[model samples]
Target: MEDFLQNLLNGIAAGSIYALIALGYTMVYGVLKLINFAHGDIFMIGSFVGFYAGRYMARHATGEAASLGSAALVLLLAMLVCGIVGYLNERIAYRPLRNAPRIASLITAIGVSFLLEYGGQMVFGPDPKFFPTLVEKKIIHLGTITTTNYQFIVLAVAIVFMGLLQYIIYGTKFGRALRAVSFNFETASLMGIPTDRIISMTFVLGSMLAAVAGILYGLSYPKIDPLMGIMPGLKAFVAAVLGGIGNVPGAVVGGLLIGIIESFVGGSQFSSYRDGIAFVILIVILLFRPSGLFGRYEPEKV
Candidate 1:
């Protein structure tokens, strides 16, 4: 029972990171029906950006204000940079391919993915860098179970971001425009909803979410590399699929579930297979319900 409780607590924080990355997958799919494979690279970029930003602050500032400023500024800077990258990705690489066959866009996304990954290694260095602590670390215990303050921070930040996302999707005009574009690109364009801009914004928003996830993951693990986003990004994709590819809430559920499963497996003797478990879930979910947990299938008409 103690072990189970401990795993559950750890899982939630791990799941929060997965959920943030998964949101990017679901949102991009919702808008363009294109899987932005470069998203993982964006996650990589965010961490690298945070690493440099933290170091720069360390050299220039001191005291309590520097501490507070570094945390906030690093996050905002990452978000802003990733957002612009996403925007340019859509505008330069994806926008022109909008009218092409789906395969073309998929290939282009793959090309972009490669560009970011290898390009990142060339620019950010090939070795892993230690992520600086943005906040002081402290351990917390519950009976025989143990956790850290960073876990709580990750969970809290995820909740706040997800809540903000919920409002953007349900309460704002931009959200409506996004939904409209998701429903039917042609119809939305005809209605003067600016489908192109909506698509760009979707990429921007999703990438920003990835940036937050990257920073949070760095805080928890503290070791980062250009390739760090690969597994988490893939797992998040599975999470999006598990929750139903185009459904927003489903992504969160899938991410949390995957995280819990990973935690349990990571703590067991079969830890070697921890990464493989996510793919197993992916295969099972696809075999049983391709639409995902919250998704409803609608047969396409010829």
Candidate 2:
């Protein structure tokens, strides 16, 4: 029982990161109907950004405030850099292909992913770097289960971001414009909505979420690498699909579910299969319930 609880806590922490990254996938799909495969790379970039920012701040500080405050400031810095990268992605690689076939955009996304991956190697070097400690680590004991404050920190920050996103999606003019653009670009344009800008803004919002995930993951694991985004990116995609590709709340549920299941599986003797479980879930979800657990079936008219 204690073991189960421990694994659950670990899973939730991991799932929160997955959910943050998955939001990027689902949101871009919601508006542009294009998957930004390079988003994972953006998350990777954010980690490196946080790595440097955290270290710089750490060096400048003298005491306790260095830990928490430094983390917060570093998070903002990473998000800002990643948000710019997301905007550039939309402006450069994707904007020209807006009127092109979906396949063209899809191929371009893959191209962008490759460019960032290899480009990251060129810029950040092809080696893994230790994520500098921004927060002092302490064990948090929950009865018989053991964890750390980082778990709670991850969950708390993720919730705050999700809440802000909910407000943005449902409580603002941009949200309405985004919804309109997603519903019908031509009609939204006819109604004076700047569809292009809305689409680009969507990418920025999603990418910032990825940045948050990247920083949180680095804090937990204390390792940053150029190619680190690949597997987590794929699994987060699976979570997005499992929760309904374009459904906002569904992405959160799917991420937690994937994380919980993967955690339980890893705790068992099937630890060797931890990485494969996500794909298996993907296959099962696709085969039986492509509409996703939270998604309603919408018939596409041909």
Candidate 3:
């Protein structure tokens, strides 16, 4: 029971990371009906950004300086850098193809993904870099479940960000504009909403979330490679679909579930095939609950 509980906690933490990145995939897809495949690369960039920034900060700090407060600051800086990178991606690569065919947009997104991957290598180099330690590796006890300070912090940040996004989507004017645009771009524009701006904002918000996820992942594992985002990004997309694409709450649910499943299955003797768990879930869900757990079924009107 204790072992199972510990695995559960770990799974939830891993899933939270997936959910954060998955939110980006679902948001862009829901609003624009575009997948934004470059999202993984955006996450990769966030890892690099956080890696360099954390290293620089550590280099200047006094010996053995590790605390929750300092960790929070590092995460904040990483979030900002990732958010800005996501905003720029939309402003430059995706915005121009807003009116293009889905195929075209997808191709453009793939191109952008390559650009970031190779460009990241060109600038940051191809070697994997170690992330500076921000948290003291102390495991916390929670009655049959022991978790690290790092896990607790990561989970807390993921929850806070998710809640903040929920508030923005449900309680803010910008969120209202986003919904209006999502429903119908032409009608939204007809009603005085700046459809273009809202679209851009959606991308920016999603990208930032992915970046944060990437940073958390780096902190969790302490090793980051340029291509790390590919698997996680793909899994996140599966999570978005599982939770019901376009549904914010669904994304969270799906992400956490996928993470947990992968962890348990991987922890078993089948660890070698852990990466395949997400796709298995994706296919199973599509074959059965096509609309997703939290996703609404919309029939096309004639």
TM-score, predicted candidate 3 vs. hidden true structure: 0.94
TM-score of 1: 0.97
lDDT of 1 by residue, 1-302 (tens): 99889989888999989999999999999988888888988988888889999888777878877787788899999999999998999999999998898889999988998898889889988899999878778899867988888999899999999999999999999999899989898999898897888888999999999999989998998999888988999999999999999899999999999999999999899989999999999999999999999998966555
User: Candidate 2: deviation at residue 19, Å?
Assistant: 0.2
Backbone clashes in model 3, listed as residue pairs = none
Instruction: Kindly list the per-residue Cα lDDT of model 2 for residues 183-210, writing each as its tens digit.
Output: 7889999999988899889989999999
Candidate 3's C-alpha lDDT? 0.86
Indicate the worst ten consecutive residues by lDDT in candidate 3: 62-71
Once fitted onto the true fold, the runs of candidate 1 whose alpha carbons sit more than 4 angstroms away are: 300-302
Error of 2 at 294 (Å): 1.6
> Per-residue lDDT of 187-276 in model 3, one digit per residue for the tens?
999999988888878988898888789888998988888888889989999999999988888999999999999989877899988999
Q: Rank the candidates by TM-score, best first.
A: 2, 1, 3
Please give the TM-score that candidate 2 achieves against the real structure. 0.98
Candidate 2 backbone overlaps, count: 0
Every candidate's lDDT? 0.91, 0.91, 0.86
